[model samples]
Target chain A: MIINHPLLGPRDAQEFTYLGDASLISRPDAQDDNAAEKFHDYLYLRDNPAGLHRELWFHESGDRSWLVVTRNTVTHEITDVQLARDVARKEGRSK
Target chain B: MRYSGFKVIKEALTGHKGWTPQWRDPEPQSHYDFVIIGGGGHGLATAYYLAKEFGESRIAVLEKGWIGGGNVGRNTTIIRSNYLLDGNEPFYEFSLKLWEGLEQDFNYNAMVSQRGILNLVHTDAQRDAARRRGNAMILNGSDAELLDVEGVRKLYPFLNFDNARFPIKGGLLHRRGGTVRHDAVAWGYARGADMRGVDIIQNCEVTGFKIEDGTCLGVETTRGYIGAGKVGVSVAGSSSRVMEKAGMRLPMESHVLQAFVSEGLKPVLPGVITYGAGHFYCSQSDKGGLVFGGDIDGYNSYAQRGNMPVIEDVAEGGISLIPALGRVRLLRAWGGIMDMSMDGSPIIDKTHIDGLYFNGGWCYGGFKATPAAGWCFAHLLKTDTPHDTATAYRFDRFRTGHMIDEKGQGAQPNLH
Candidate 1:
């Protein structure tokens, strides 16, 4: 599987580590009353769709950047790839 | 129908007209006392045990596709209790014992072959680890033998023992551990469950869950909404997705694990053999096909297919261990979705939702744990408590720092 990284151009999927759904970056506020439950959901819950899915893949063997790859789980077709941090920032998620 | 030599002869004499479908394809009823969301081996076994042992009735196993079309039928078919951890060893040993009496218990021929399994050691540290694991197995009331280099060579003379990169130092042999007919296991369990009046509903896709005020009432499927007193989710790869409908998240990842089978040949592998230096394990099936598999795709996927790199990597491992395999033709390759848990151990426990239960995260051990998983899961559903053998497979283990990390991989799903 060739994952075309945003910065590293095209790289083999073997070099990356899978971190599962990209929704992980949108963690809830830690100060909320339901922070524990929210954190639990953030860490564990996944919308593992059978078709198109956005997942987090770390380029461990390349630039060390986490890439959010929009892929079809059924066909394994990669439609888009971007830095996970950039995607998180675009989605109004920040440290 | 009782399957026997006489029945076979009679059927043959009568042109095989006495045969019936192994299981009934019943329409989904409006409600059942127990609803199992997957018709794979574990789910069917759960239903079978619920009826046979727990004296429960009105059970139904719902499968999106045909039975045995999941990881239950896609594995290397090896069953072993050579685990090194307390959280996993006893449970697997129990499963092994169930496999021993499975044919008589189910009244069907499952081909539970206890040929043995050898984990080849390649280094001094590996030898020490194998010794520790063997000791653990013995402590758990299972057999384990540490075979020296000469013993390994005697059993498998065709191995690439003299190779410099990964020399064969010794091995850990579990004599009671071996392979079974993967599909036959599903069939036997389904037949047993069906005979016990458990409805096996196929082509029933569960689209959502019907949870009311923190209690599961039923499931909404493609066919329709079916009510249930309790629901058990045993969908291996789709555990995360299925549970999501109930507003629950699981600390598990779904990845595609590919397996391969070579063309038939003269019987070569006496039993199962696993490479110490790599993730390659293989055994010769009854039909003489060399069935083998390696690592997952290292990516989350619900797809039941794999790519070429993993295939090439598995082939490389096979060649590194058995140089003779280089000349053999690869007949077919397939994939199964592995429900890899954070701690590399399975969870068979009730969910936070009141009437919902879960039995998954079997990882690569799903097929081997089929019998005990079913039995223990049925016990949990019937009595609302974990079986003695599966007490450590609780959902709170991860949060409580009691992760049953058999491989000690430390939260890495792919590594496990």
Candidate 2:
């Protein structure tokens, strides 16, 4: 059901992450500090790399606000991150 | 006998063996206190309320087929009171309150669940709309919350979080909305009203009404002529057909609304989830089957069968929400025609006829609003005064421009 477009890579199960359940927003227990940010939004990886050549590549995080995440596609190492608008403009793609 | 909860215990100790009638002859009574047509939820509810309010027991609820066999039973059993418009919010809130206590009132297990309903937003604009709706719920004294993408992931882990087409941006969480047993709702009201000495004459379709001067004097059913002082038309989908008999035409279109069920699973979804971007919504029934429905057919048709386009749209939306549903085979699909009105809100007011009343134009919210609709329609029947919330849902609102345009697209049948 996770159909990755031609521009996007196929969904890999290993890349998925479980931040928490989907009901924290409705619960009064989530009103405390950091729960709104850490537990409010859920994150999941759509891929599980099968190759040995580990390359750290950055991609948009598929949210409304564009994100630039630097992570190993194979070894899954986090190296760099920023908003796509901030990082891409610095790289002279602001035509 | 006073009306109480659902269970009824007969008492012989107080000379109160219920009302002993003269069993008057079936002769056209010439004038009845009240006559309600269309024995669906609305009509029956109206009768029950009328008796309770006005001490008027001379009410007859007429039906064409077996009572409760209409859209009352065919609806996809979902209930929610979270509305965004002005006129709709209060009416639905009344309905939600009735649903919460329906089991105790009807003495029948309606299987009403507060399993919650999630409207998943996929874009910034959709998130804004969801936020507005959530705020509207709060303003109307209903519980609602705005959920972010992370909030959605934490709750529904099975969704495709990475898919750009329907990325989990956020959602509007209505904690009180859920599903109910559709048929039990009809049966409970029927048995309860029947116990109250309301004569339920089924299989007697009203072919025509006897009009005297400008007032509806009586009804001419297939069985025979029946006299009544007041008549209420609570037919949902058949509003056009029945109204045409009175020389009145409605701004209504008839189309089938279909629901699909998948093979029983281990109950993956705990509540109903509606795709804000697509016409897909689903909830797990008590029997572990996934009961879901989507948009109505754009064209007018009486056929209860649907085509492939809506099926594909709903399936794709379902798969987007829960990736695991792709493995579950769809058990079946069926349809019911909706009485979609021009303004999307319902019309529960007196017609131009002096003695005739109407309660139609519920659109998709018919099932959820059945109880409150009955209550209000009954109030109108007894006092001839409109409820404060439903005053603007009149037939004249279409021309006066006082429309309750819920979708904000003006008067159109496809208000989804």
TM-score per prediction, in order, is 0.95, 0.75
Put down candidate 2 lDDT per residue, A1-94, tens digits, no spaces.
1213224445331232211111211233356676544331211100112122111122224433333444432232334444445655665556
- Of all native A–B interface contacts, model 1 reproduces a fraction of 0.53
Q: Write the residue-wise lDDT of candidate 2 on B103-170 in tens digits.
A: 88867778899999998888899988888888888888888999998988888888777787667788
Which residue pairs in candidate 1 have backbone atoms (N, alpha carbon, C) closer than 3 angstroms, thus clashing? none
- Candidate 2's C-alpha runs over 4 A off are A1-95, B1-31
Candidate 1 per-residue C-alpha lDDT over B233-346 given as tens digits, one digit per residue, 9 for 90 to 100: 999998988988887778888889999999998989999999999889999999989999999987777788999989999999999999999999999999999998888899
TM-score (chain A only) of candidate 2: 0.31
Every candidate's chain B TM-score: 0.99, 0.91
